[model samples]
Target: MQADIQLLLTADGSHTVRHETLGVTYHSIHGAVQESQRVFIELGLQAAFERFANVPLRVFEMGFGTGLNALLTAREAERHGRPVAYTGVEAYPLPPEESQKLNFDVALGTTFLNALHASPWHETVNISPFFTLNKQQTSLQNWQTNERFHLVYYDAFAPSAQPELWEPEIFQRLACFLLPGGLLTTYCSKSYVQRNLRAAGFTVEKHPGPARKREVLRAISPPIL
Candidate 1:
C-alpha cells in the first residue's frame, strides 16, 4: 500500500517524510541528519570500520527512504578513502518530486543526492570511486540475495508502525545474510526488539541516541563456532 506522505521540517532543521496513514515519520522527529549520523554512521559504519579496517564494506540498508543514510555513508567513504558496496531496499520509493524537496544536499554540502535517487533500481551503480550503490525495489521479506553484508542499517519504520518487520522471524531471516561479527544498527531501543535480535543470535547493545532520542540499538552477529 502506498502511503500518503508529506515532507516536514524536523527540530534540527532537516527534512523528514511523515506517513499520514501510519502516523510515523521516516526518520526521528528530532533531527533526520543528526539521527542518521549517530545511529547509522558513527555507531554502524564507523564502528564496523574499526573491526574490519580498510577492507571494502558491504553495507545493507533496510529502507532507502529519502536516501539520507546512503548519501552520508557515501560521503564518509569518500572522506576516509574507504570502499563501500552499499545496497538499499525500498518497497515504496519516494517519487522525484517528493525526494527533491529534502535539504540534505545543502546540509551535507554535496550535490550527489539527486544522483542517488536517479540511479536505477536492482542494478549496481558506482556513485563514486569509494561508493557503489544498488537500490533494490523490493521488500526485505521478498528480497533474496546470497551475498552477505558487513553492516546493516535497519532504518525501517518503527515497530509500532510496521510490526511485521521487527518480529523475531524477520530478524532471524535477516540474520542469515549477516557475516559473522557483522553489525546492525537502528534508532529503536524497544525491549522486545532487543529480545528478538537476541533470539536471532545477535549480541545486542544500546547506545546513546542522537538529538532528543535517549537510546538506540546496535546488534552484532556472533562469531562462528
Candidate 2:
C-alpha cells in the first residue's frame, strides 16, 4: 500500500491531509479531508444524531483514513455529553503514531485527538463517558456484523483511484447493516454512485458538495415496520 503525507486547504482556509494508500495527500488542490469533515461529520453525522436524539448514538465509518471523522465525532459527543458508539472500518489502518498528529484541538478544538489515540485498540474500547470507538482493521467488503448503525460515514478514495470500493455489491452488503431510517453520507454525488445506493435499497439524494466540489450524496433507509 502507498502512503502520502501533505497539506490541503479548506474553504475556510483550514488544513488537513494524510494518505495511507496513495502518495500525495489532498485530492487535487483543495483540502479533501476538510471537505469530508464539513460534509460528512458536521452536515451528515450531526444531522443524523439530531434526528435520533437518544442516548448512545451508533456510527459506522468507512475508510477510517486519518481518523479525522472519528476524532471530530468524539469531540462532539464529549462536548454535548451524548453517549456515542462509533465503529470504523479501514482496510489499511493508520498507525497510532501517525494518527496522533490529527490534533482536532488545533483545528476543531475538542481534545479529540488525544482521546482517540488514548483509546486502546482491542475487541472494543471505551474512550470516554460519552464515546466508545471500535475499529475493524479489514476491508469492509468482508466485514460481518448484525449490529445496526444509525449513521454511516462513507469516505473512500475517489472513484478514479479506487474503483472497487464503489461497486454496487459492496454497497448492497453495507446497506444490510443500516437500521431502518439510518442515513449514509459521502462526498461523491455522481449519478452512478446514487444509482448504486438506490439499487442497494436506499432512498438517495443529491446534495451540494463541500468546498470546491460540485455535489455530495446522502441516502436513508426506511424504518422497518
Candidate 3:
C-alpha cells in the first residue's frame, strides 16, 4: 500500500510529516534535523559515546525517516572528534529533491543541513572523515547483517500502526544485530513492547520520556561471550 504523507507544524515550531499508514511521524522540523540533534545526538548517541569513550562509535537505527537522526549524529561525531559508522534502514525512500526542500538548515544550522544534503541517496555514502551514513531502502523484515552494533535507535512505528514490526520475532531480529552489552532506546512506552523486548532477551527498563511524552523504553543486552 502507498504511504500517505502530509506536512504539519509541530509544537516545537518544526515542520513534521505524518505517515498515515505506518502511523509514524517525521519531523520535517528540518526533517531529521530536529530529531537527530534532540533525540539521538544530544541524548542517546552522545551518552553512549561518552560511556564508551572510544575513538570510533558504531550506531544502527531502525527507521531512517527524513534522515534527521543521521544528520544530527554526524554533527555530534564531528564535534567529539570521534569517527562514527552508521547504518540506517528505511522502507520508503524519499528523493533528494524533496529532502532539500525540507528547510532543516534554518533551525538545525546550515552546516548540518549541508552535511545532510551531501549524504548520498540509494547507497552508503560517506559525508566526512568522522561520519559515515549508509541507508538501505527496504523494510526491517528484509534486514540481514552480521555486523554487531553498540547502539540501536528503535524508531519503528507504534504497534497499533504496524503490529508485525512490533512482534517478538522482529525484536529477536534486533537482538541478533547487537553486540554484547549493546543498548536500545525508543520513544515508545507500551508495556507490550517492553514485554516483547524482554522475551527477545533484552533487559528492559522504563525511563522518563521526552518533552510531552509520559514514558519511554530503554533496553540493554548482556555482555557478549
Candidate 4:
C-alpha cells in the first residue's frame, strides 16, 4: 500500500507532502515548520531537556516523513551543546529526489537535510558532534528495540487517515520503550488517542497548539518506583 504523494507549499511558506491516496498531509497545512517547532521541539524536546538536564537524550520519532522534526531536533542539540541520539522509523521512505525538494534547509538556513536523508538505514550516523541519527526502515508496529528513549515524537498521520496506527495496542507497544518519565508528543488531540495513551499508562496533557491548531497532546510515562 504505497502512498501516492505530492509536495505542497504550506501556510508558513515551508513544504509538506500530501498522500494523494489517503488524502492526508504529512504535516499541518498551517505551517510545516511551525507545527514541528511547536509540537515536537518547544513542547517535546525542550521539555525533555528541562527534565533530564545535561544527560544525553534519546528520541524515537514514529514517522520520519520529511525529516523536518529530526533536523529541528538536531539543530536544537547543537545549539545547546547537548548530546542527542535520534531514531526515526519510517516504513516507506521518501525517495532522494523527493526529499531534496523540501524547503526546510533553506528555511532554517542549514544544509544538514541531505546528510540526514543520506544516512544509512538501521545504523547510527553521527550528523554532528552533538547529534546522531538512526533512520530505521520499518513500521512502528513491527519495530522493536530493548533500548529505551527519553522522548518520542509521535508524528504519524492523522487517525482518520490511518486508524490502524492509532489503535491502543500500538500505543501500548510504543509505551514499553519509553523510559519512566519519558514523554510522547503529537499534534493529535483526539479524545480516543488520549484515552489510548492513558490506557497505555501515560499521564496525558493537552496544550495550546501552534498556528491554526487548537491543541496538541503530550503523554508522560509514570516515574519508576
* Model 4 C-alpha lDDT per residue in residues 1-225, reported as the tens digit of each score: 344789999999999999998889999899999999999999999999998997999999999989999999999998999999999999989988889899999999877899999999999999999999999999887887999999999998888888998888988887888899999999999999999988888899999999998999999988861
For candidate 4, the lDDT comes to 0.92
Better of 3 and 4 by TM-score: 4
Q: All models: lDDT?
A: 0.92, 0.74, 0.72, 0.92
Question: Candidate 4: deviation at residue 150, Å?
Answer: 0.3
RMSD of 1: 1.0
lDDT of 2 at 183: 88
TM-score of each model, paired residue for residue: 0.98, 0.86, 0.87, 0.97
Candidate with better lDDT, 1 vs 2? 1
Report the alpha-carbon TM-score of model 2 versus the true structure: 0.86
> What does candidate 3 score on TM?
0.87
Model 3 C-alpha lDDT per residue in residues 139-159, reported as the tens digit of each score: 889877888888898887666
Tell me which residue pairs clash in candidate 2. none
Which window of 10 residues has the lowest lDDT sum in candidate 2?
Answer: 20-29
Tens digit per residue, CA lDDT, model 1, 119-189: 99889999999999999999999999999999999999988889999999988887888999999999999
Q: How badly does each model clash, as a count of residue pairs?
A: 0, 0, 4, 0
Per-residue lDDT of model 2, residues 27-110, tens digit only: 324654467666777767788878788757889988777667887787778778888899888776656555665544676656
